[model samples]
Target: MNRATLLTLGVTMLAPLGSAYAADDVKVVEKPIRVLAGIFSAASGANKQRTAIGVGYDFMKTAATNPTVYGVFLDYNSKKVAGVTTSLTGVGISGRFYLESANAAGKPYATLGVGSYTLKAGTSQSKIGGKLGIGYELNNGWLGELSSTMIQKIGGKDPGGVTFGIGYRF
Candidate 1:
């Protein structure tokens, strides 16, 4: 099976877990205002290259005493090709788990999630990945993050690779 198919299958297998969150209260939130742009390197076996620019957004969510955050994000990327170029577009749900720091300042965090990726190779796919980042919270309810991810490709022609971006928490 190809990556997209595997993703769909995996999500299908995990459909029951969605019900667990039903007991939790659902709330709407907005986050701090910030943006980040950076470059990412990707390698499949031995062929590797770096993309010149990668972009991401941070939509801050409600910050409790524990300072958890939730938001939506989108990312775009491109790969060099001889005649035509290949590209990837990803959109998914994102969140952060914070570690309380000394002095009551913004804390460090780690995040992970799955999303869909549209590739130029004729198939749009869904992928699962994990990320780790360091973040700081300013006095004004603003949070900034720098993180990286390695998405697993189940069915695409290319093996999954790494992505880097920034985030914000309100």
Candidate 2:
């Protein structure tokens, strides 16, 4: 037990892993990016179809863990069928789960989304939707939103809709 006392107990256990690489080295803070659009509708109450226009995007955050918002959305859904003059184009990939309460400051917050629609005579559809909405954030960085999306078309028998939207968040 005396090889210089086992080399002084392995240099006192490697001096706490060499003082953890001299500590202080970890600083990363970068969060600034948000974009949104407006106008969307797909509705039916015994064929009372209401479809609108104007849509937008630019929102990317794969996973957020503090008031849930997991995202990847670049969406555009259009419609114009005023009497069979047919017009429909939906190109999308959308997924969102939302909840944000900033201690009730200028209130309104609740969102839930799911989308997969590709229809420009290419017939590919999937949308299981949700939206019970209210949103307000105006401190010059305008974010005024009102949402609703209740879609069900996962195989083709397309007749399910409820989308009312207004958005602007940059």
Please, what is the TM-score per model?
0.57, 0.24
**Number of clashes recorded per candidate:** 7, 0
TM-score of 1: 0.57
In the range 65-160, model 1's lDDT, one tens digit per residue, is 554455555666666666555565666655655666323755666654456655554445655544345666654555455555456654534534
lDDT of 2 by residue, 1-170 (tens): 22344334334433433333355321221222334455555453222334444343423332233233333344444544533322233333332223444333443445443344443323444443333345565434456665554444444444334444444444
Window of ten residues with lowest summed lDDT in model 2: 24-33
Model 2 residue 23 CA deviation (Å) reads 28
Please report the candidate that would top lDDT against the real structure.
1
Tell me which residue pairs clash in candidate 1.
2-155, 3-154, 3-155, 30-60, 31-60, 32-170, 106-137
lDDT of each: 0.50, 0.40
